[model samples]
Target: MADYQQIFQVSRNQAIKDVKEGVFELSRSAVIFYPKEGSFDCVARPWLTEAGSRSARGIWEIEFNHKLLRYIYGLTNQFTTYSLRDCGSLRNPRTIRLYESLAQFKSSGLWVTTHAWLNDRFLLPESQQKNLAELKRSFLDPALKQINEKTPLLAKYSIDDSGKFLFSIIDKQNPV
Candidate 1:
């Protein structure tokens, strides 16, 4: 008997292969916050899901809607799909599960990138490094009064700062 993981992989693999071969288009639209652009755009793509929801324990379940699958298919037809994970050590166990789950996919198309990750903490000067740590703490500190109480726009998506989202674009293929 096949496990749910195996079943999901089988179905997802076939979908990826079929789309890659140009049998049909796969596409979906997502409501994502783009902090750099300072705008929320309906990004159309082949498949979009909050990563690791399936493999994670507790309340988080992978939210897969048919609309997203279709859009993902269509988007894959045009541009390739890339996968990214949160940077640094796995602070959250649920996120770790998500990372591990995505790691097993057979598709060669997906490339791993670091999303909202501060690069090279060691590289910073001693004073600057201290500042960064303090900054991170300050951003995470709720007691500090902030303008955007709901969503603080921080530089580079630091939790210690008020940032919506942080994205590093490598290998840009025709910005959408």
Candidate 2:
């Protein structure tokens, strides 16, 4: 098996704290490229194990149906690879999901999606924001801030003339 090294930002200390306090919610999403369904949930299990004498560390293991894993890792051409650490560092689930989704288009450095898409994928309530501007102010900006500051990835977005969001990823090798 090939070793995959995608790190999530939750530190050992934080993980231990969360685990012990029973405050952790482990969530995973598998994005499907060409499909009737775009994404599906996967199970995550987090626990603490001894690292050394009088020391312990957190471990998070994900469980996926073999078919799903095969489809995601084997068959999908459109997929995002992100550090779990970065995702964990994000306070909002929407922000984390956005990061993972956008990371798929890092090579292009650009992604365009509609407000409706965001509303659907992030599970934003219809009563939450009345307009795009309000949505951007309340949700998008804060999420972008966290993604830029906490992760290796950086993002910026604009509302196009057609009212679609045009998001651009800053190239890590040549940041502006």
Candidate 3:
């Protein structure tokens, strides 16, 4: 966990530097979670503090609304930590989201969903990629390929009679 924190710190610093250098602009409102209880949003922009400053005092910190701290604490307590290194290495956001979501199913290692469900889950606009074949070509194949090659887990996907995608994770140690 300490190693992950270090990695996160390095990545965060680089992102901050990039934003400061005008490499890219980030959205003012970044939402982390939206549960029934409340929502957690990130501060629009964060700046480094000078030495002896009151808040954060010489360190770079992104201020979040108070709700986020509670949300993070609850999340940490409820969930087990998984290696972020592999997920961070993924270039595709969809792949990373899918990988993390699948990690939640470590016990069963199986997930099934329709193309419509996948489109909604990944937040792809309906106007884009209308058919299953197109979805497979543009999104599914690439994400699966990257996940299988770059991560420790292996993924196998198939289409059922109802045209739903069935994904099963193969245990690397107990391959059949």
Clash pairs detected, candidate 3: none
List the candidate 2 regions with Cα displacement exceeding 4 Å: 1-78, 173-176
Clashes of each: 24, 7, 0
* Reference-based TM-score, model 3: 0.60
Mark the 10 consecutive residues where model 3 has the least summed lDDT: 46-55
- lDDT (10s digit) by residue, model 3, range 102-134: 666655878887877787889875543477777
Residue 102 CA displacement from its true place in model 1, Å? 22
Q: How high is the CA lDDT of each candidate model?
A: 0.33, 0.65, 0.63
| lDDT, residue 101, candidate 2 | 77
Residue 72 Cα positional deviation in candidate 1, in Å, after optimal superposition: 1.6
Which of candidates 2 and 3 is the stronger one according to lDDT?
2
Top of the candidates by lDDT: 2
Clashes of 1: 24
lDDT at position 55, candidate 1 = 21
Candidate 1's displacement at residue 35, Å, is: 26
lDDT of candidate 2 over 22-76, digit per residue (tens): 3223233333344455474543332222222222424434444445555546635
Poorly placed runs, candidate 1 (over 4 Å): 1-59, 83-176
